[model samples]
Target: MSAADDRLAARVRALAAAVEAAEGRSDAAVSADARAVVERAGERVAFSGSYTVVALAGATGSGKSSLFNAVTGTELARVAVRRPTTAKPMAVSWGSELPHALLDWLDVTGRHLVPSGPHELSDLVLLDLPDHDSTEVSHRLTVDRLVELVDALIWVVDPQKYADAALHEGYLKRLAPYADVMMVVLNQADRLTPEELDRCLGDLRRLLDAEGLRATPIMAVSALRGTGIKELREALARTVANKQAMTRRLSADVTVAATALAADLGTANVPRVDERLQRQVVAGLGAAAGVPIAVDGVRRAWRKRGTVATGWPFVTWLARLRPDPLKRLRLDLTPGDHSPTEVNRTSLPKASAVQRARADQGLRELTDAATSGLPRGWASAVRNAAGDRRAVLLDRLDVAIAGTDLEVRRGTWWWGLFGVLQWLLIAAVVVGAVWLLANPLLLGLGLPQLPPVLWYGVPAGTWLLVGGVLAGLLLGVLGRALVEIGANAHARDARRSLEDAVRAVVTEEVFEPVEAELARYRLARQQVAEAART
Candidate 1:
């Protein structure tokens, strides 16, 4: 392939990539049209650019077949007066090798090779296409298809129908973007006088200007009388020699395809997920996961466990009789050992309808916010991405919560100290009770009497008993207050830990997928923009 062909092929490939990226996310009609353009252009570019392919397109009875025969110097295409003569396309190749591959791609079976002649215009393949306005549907369809594939368009118009709306509005106006590869010819010019010819040519130029085809070349020719065939031949020779018609035509196709898809790529910036949306998602998931109830369980469990460790020895057993709050909820309140043990499921209730609705609403709001400036189809795609895995969302969140280590089992330094103090008090009470009982037993046995010792006007044995009882009760009260304070702080920390776990799940399951889609859109838009430039 030539450098020019490679460049054209690159542009076509880029367009094809963009269209594929947008296939399910854009308007079906627009994407289909773009895909067709890429396919047709690929087929056309595969053939060598040794010759130029020009088509003579016009309405029925516009003398196009006559001009085709005149150009080829033979009666190749059938010229008739029965309304529509050419039903299918006829091709005439001069001097250059036959482009069988190209003709096969064009589906043109009616082909002829011109006899050896002046090699000035040898590298030209002229096609006589079906009438654009034929009453037969197939003829018009064939014309429409060939017009897009040909390298250059030579519209053959007669003086009588030069101003026809079908010629100007249907073909010329729509083909304004391809003016570089387009030409207009007034055929059968022998019938008009010099003044009439000039006036007609001037009026045609004005009409072409109105159709945005001001740069298109115009010529006066008579295929039958051969008045201006030489000029037309010279023009064809110049175009074939340049060999840029194929490149120009392909470039124009890319531009048109890109324009059709412009609506889908309205803005360059991809939408982003805001902090508010992230917070809302976390809140909803937390609610669905019963985070509040779990935190409360942590608090209650800490208090009960702490009481067993530091409560007065007399009633510490009572505390063990009641069920552990965290255990009942099926949670391990113990600090994580970082082992590979299986995580326990929480007995929290399933999310109610109201909770589910709130979560769904938050997801919708996130989608809307992220896709605010995107096209409708792209916005819809993003919204669909957000909800694509919604059925599995709650299950995933529950797993995340269960895997979290709430650090509820972490013990405070004061807890151990209080435990030791409680044990010492129990020992003191035991020792003092033994002393009081032994004193009475010794007196009853009539042993030798001993002097009585007193503290603050009480006997020594009585002092020991009363002090132990009062001090142990006071220490128990202080330990209970400390346990309450520690439990409250622990609950707050557990709630934070659960929230962090829930946030991570939301990011993985929801935000990442949506961002990935936006990244795809960004890449597609970039490809389309580059293709358009080419």
Candidate 2:
């Protein structure tokens, strides 16, 4: 084998290792697509070096029967009189040493041992596959799996149907990527005139080129007449002699499988969250929970500057008194408090079924777009990851909104009553204090300013009235400030909780899967590069 061929074999081994890694982590939140590809690849690698498979693939009645007989030098495969008779695969080998391990892996137990012949093709273990246009679905699957794993394929096309659409569309188009390991044989040249044969060959060449098979070797031969059997034999012999052809074929298979496995890795470039969307979600949740109104009311009532005694002491006491509205209503709005004690659906906006459905649709669309460049299996993995966590995501969001709603406390009429009683008590105390002092000189100074009744009967009545009025005004301001403070705190708490919830869902359900897939892909790619080097 050439140095290049040695490198190619090594590369295949490396690719196998990467696939094994994926399989090992199959249960660890891996994408379904990635897992499938890795599993397929691992199976192939496990069976490598077990057997040498040379598959005969071609259009219907392409004289592959004749060619198969000539190569094996036996009537092991039925010929012309029995054209298209084999409806299934038949294998012939020249020796018993042809590796039972390989045969077991191919799942073909009906093995035949053909005696070694003088023909150069004797060393090969030949496979006469069923017609590509077979009526059976099993036949098609057999052909497909063989095409994926076979060391080399001999594509036989007779003059009559060299350009058959079924062969090109159903087979060649899909196998274009494997062109390097494929060979096109223009069989049954005996049926055409020299000029007609030349034109047919030319047409076949053009078709092959159009199918992205420019580098694949094309050969013309008459399998029945055995006109070009010697040349075909020599070509097969040369490939076996060097061992490079087989190595290159294996290398190409490894790369193809690797490409599929690597796609399990999520996208390298992640789409970021839009700032506008973030802001909108935050505002929407806050407004729907009535956070702003609560905060504003508290701020307006609670003032930092105020006097308890000089300005209607009774009223001032009422303003300074805090309602503790959220606490009284049994709202659990403390930091680190995740769920609400009670779900106030009336105050909070519930995500409707329609909204949940929309979210699901959006997730599917985003996942599809993110994995558009990946293999079908890898794309499937992303989809499963998104689907599995969808309900959980919605539920967490609902809980967050509900939790916020409970914190948006509205100071009701009872709070106003409490304010009034607090002020009245302060007024009573201020009146009693002046009455107890009973200072005649201080009372006389205010006597002239007081009403005649107040000057004669009650000494501290004027001062008491002024103190009660000032106290009421101060109490009203304090009530407003307390309400505002509570509202602001609740709003901030809800926002933080929501942010945490969102991040948790995204990481567990989305980012983790993406990371696992990427790891598989990176490993597969590494294997391909290493195998190529070997």
Candidate 3:
């Protein structure tokens, strides 16, 4: 392919991708019409490029077939007085071998090859299309279909219906974008007086101007009287010579398709998943996954384990009597053992209706934040994407929370030192008590008198009993205070870890899908912009 052909093909492919991207998200009719344009243009571009396909289109009783015959200098199409005479299209090819593939693609069965003539119009394949305003729906349908495929259109109008609303409003205005490749011919001009013909041509020009077709050429032609036929043939010869009709027509098609889809590409500003939105998502998921309750459980469990480790040895049994809070929640007491099977369902309560509603609202807010500047259609698509798997969101979140390894083990060195000290103090107090109790037994057995120990002028036995008991109580109280503080810090850390895990789930389950949709929209916008550019 040449550079121009490669460019056009690339554009067509871009347009096709845009249409595919918009299939389910955009209006069905708009997407279908764009798809049709892409398909038809692709077929035309791939076929023979040597000939230009020009169609003579008009309403009923406009002498379109007569103009067709006059231009080709052969009676190719059957002209009749009956309304809507040409039910099917007839083609007249000039100068070269018949483009059978092109004609077949156009579905024009009636073909005529004209001998080479003086007009130098050898590269033209002129078609006489059915009346666009025919009472028969099929004829109008045929006209609509062929008009889209033709390389250039010569709209044949008669003075009687030159300014008719049906012709101007239905065909001319809709095709205004193709003005560069369109022409208006006032057929049967010989029937009017010269003065009347001039007035009618001027009025037709004004009407075309109103329809936004000011650049489209208009000429007066009479197929029967042969007036102004040369000018029409010359105009067509120029079109065939330039060989840009196909490109112009295809470009116009792209414009129309892109314009139809412009509403969907609301803004060039791409939507983003920002940190604030991600935080909102994490917060919501945290609530739904019951992170607060789990964190609280971890804190209580930490304190319980700390009491067992650092409390006075005799009273520490009381702490052991209570179940470990983390164990009750099915959380691992040890850190870093994160086997999937080791984790179990948490005893944390299910999310209440209020919490679930808050979570849902948070998700909606995140969606709104991400799609803030987008068009309504695109915003709706993004929101829908976020909620696509909403039914399973809670289950996934629960599993994520369960799988998170919250570091809740209480293995501090200070606690172990405090535990040994508590044990040594308890031993001192027990030994002193036993020594005092055995005094009576020693007297009853008539044993020798025990030596009295003294410390700072007081008996060492009394000092051991009072000092050990008091110090043990003080150490236990201080250790409990330290454990409480440490537990709170641990709880905070665990909460943060759980939130991070939930955020990961939110990103994977919600934000990722929404982001993917936004990416698609961005790609589609880029492709459309490229295809629509000149």
**TM-scores, one per candidate:** 0.91, 0.59, 0.92
Model 1 CA deviation exceeding 4 Å by range: 1-10, 81-84, 115-118, 268-270, 333-344, 441-464
Pairs of colliding residues, candidate 3: none
| C-alpha root-mean-square deviation, candidate 2 | 9.1
> Using lDDT as the measure, what is the rank order of every candidate, best first?
1, 3, 2
Cα lDDT of candidate 3 equals 0.84
On lDDT, the leading prediction is 1
Best by TM-score: 3
Query: lDDT by residue for model 2 over 183-277, one digit each (tens)?
Result: 89999888889999889988998999999989788888887788888888787777665555555665555555555555443345533334454
What TM-score would candidate 3 get against the native?
A: 0.92
Model 2 TM-score is 0.59
lDDT of 1 by residue, 113-149 (tens): 8766668767688899998988889999999989989
For candidate 1, the lDDT comes to 0.85
Winner by TM-score between candidate 3 and candidate 2: 3
How much is the lDDT of residue 370 in candidate 1?
80
